[model samples]
Target: MLNKNLQNTKFDIRFFILCSIFFVVTSPFASCSAPPKLKTQTLTITRFDKSTITLVAEIAKTEEEKEYGFMNRKDIPDGTGMLFVYKKDIHLSFWMKNTPLPLSIAYIDSKGIIRELYDMTPYSLAPIIGQYACRYALEVPQGWFSANNITVNSKIDLSSL
Candidate 1:
């Protein structure tokens, strides 16, 4: 019984140490922070083909908006979506947790050029990580990008708003 107790104690110590190490290593970099202030607004998106489509988007500019995201939402109105803005470029990561509507996300670079597009599954915890660094993310209804001819290199005219 004494040996069993010692083994358990050692395991607990090791577990605690591992957790501490992980925290120390990742503390400086914000993995996931508070949600940002989201606002319902509008923006014009210019496709690679020179066609433009305007959308009523909820701009996620604060930490609170980013965290809450589209969670618990049943639908995104037609011609409207959500846009996440970052101070600088980052490898954008997104997931659908408690979000019932399927979405397509576009990673936009600092120049407002669309760098990547990915379809996301509804209510999925699996992360959709961007392969390139970007300063903004736009989330719209699934197939919205393709249907509207929005593709890589498309511009999301971020200069105005």
Candidate 2:
């Protein structure tokens, strides 16, 4: 009777351990939640013609945020974009890996003037490098710059952001 009881106790312990492992393996999938929405800021672009355009941009200030720019997004609203802020002027490179939006990025200097512009293909791993050192980068839907007449040297008004 004693041996039988010991065997039953061992079986119960093994069963509990297996159940714990199963829960640990499946917990992430079972309790998964939607990703948090990014924070947005208002920014304005001033063309050489003196005309101004306003945009609502998600601010990517942290390294993690900058790395995850626009990834998995199904769509971006018109007049919406992303602003990647850096602490200092540096040669910045961006890639479209895991990002679904067709985007155009403008590398901007500390004075808020766009220094270079490049169009990025969706999901491409190729790096789109800035032609000059930049303190910020603005990303909008592909063709937005040309369609709106925004080009290199166009000023971005970050005072309101």
Candidate 3:
């Protein structure tokens, strides 16, 4: 009877250990809290006059990221641009609804050429429309394009990404 009782206690201990192990392994996934996002790469772009600008871009690979792109970002670091990627080529327009940072947006073509550029004010909520349909739009600090002489018909190199 003592041997049987010892065997039962061992089984109970083993069961408890297995439960603890399962919780340790799977608790992270079961938690509803979202993990912090990770950045993959830093992008470097050039102006029409050959001035270089280094930007840490947030990749808009998903629909949600594209939709909520830079909406609440109050300050964008100088010499950096936010790169927005779309699944397909379409007419893209951005408004400063929730954005509180002054920005200059560049509409890029499929060949990574700047099709249009616009300087936008912070917290305006006014629609900053693109002149032509583009596959991507890059947001930089206000007057960055003009200051660097980056304009329409200028090519943007994405080889660094």
Candidate 4:
């Protein structure tokens, strides 16, 4: 009688284990039926020589805005950039700090001429110190200007901004 009882207990345990595995294997497909929604905004920024590079830009205007740049965003759409507008052109500097995207920053003077360009790696907090006074700084994906043939002294169109 005791042997029969042990065998029944072992069978019950095996059945329970099989049920657990079946549930675990099937749960993932049930929950992964849809893609998660994301938030996005529209923006536009132009470049020199009247050539407009329309893109979705995340604008950073104030001190708070500058401090919290694009920290959490993983992917930035092609032709989109982050624009940093300041009151005056001065010795401006930026760091990778919390920014997770690899970017190239174009430093523009008050006249909107491209003064300099710096390529920054993701999560690098080193300061992007500018040698001259700059009024605007445009941050785009690394090699964006080079790939688009944009260079220093090139004119950036911002009449629409």
Strongest candidate by TM-score: 2
How much RMSD separates candidate 1 from the native structure?
A: 8.7
**How well is each residue in 1-161 modelled by candidate 4, as lDDT tens digits?**
99999999999999999999999999967733332232233533344554655556676777766766666667877787778889877888988865778999989888778899999989887888999899988888898888877778877655545
Poorly placed runs, candidate 2 (over 4 Å)? 1-36
For each candidate, give its TM-score against the true structure.
0.75, 0.78, 0.67, 0.66
Report RMSD for candidate 4: 8.9
lDDT score for residue 99 of model 2: 81
Q: Where does candidate 1 have its weakest 10-residue lDDT segment?
A: 28-37
Better of 2 and 3 by TM-score: 2
Instruction: Tell me the deviation in Å of residue 11 in model 2.
Output: 14
Q: What is the lDDT of residue 151 in candidate 2?
A: 89
Question: Mind giving the per-residue lDDT tens digits that candidate 3 earns over 94-140?
Answer: 88766778888988887788888888887787787776778889888
TM-score of 1: 0.75
* 42-145 per-residue lDDT for model 2 (tens digits): 88889989899888899988887887788777898888999999999999999997788899999999999999999999999999987799999999999999
Q: Candidate 2 vs. truth: CA RMSD?
A: 4.2
Off by over 4 Å in 3: 1-40, 50-52, 159-161
Report lDDT (CA) for all predictions.
0.87, 0.89, 0.75, 0.76
* Candidate 4 Cα errors over 4 Å, as ranges: 1-52
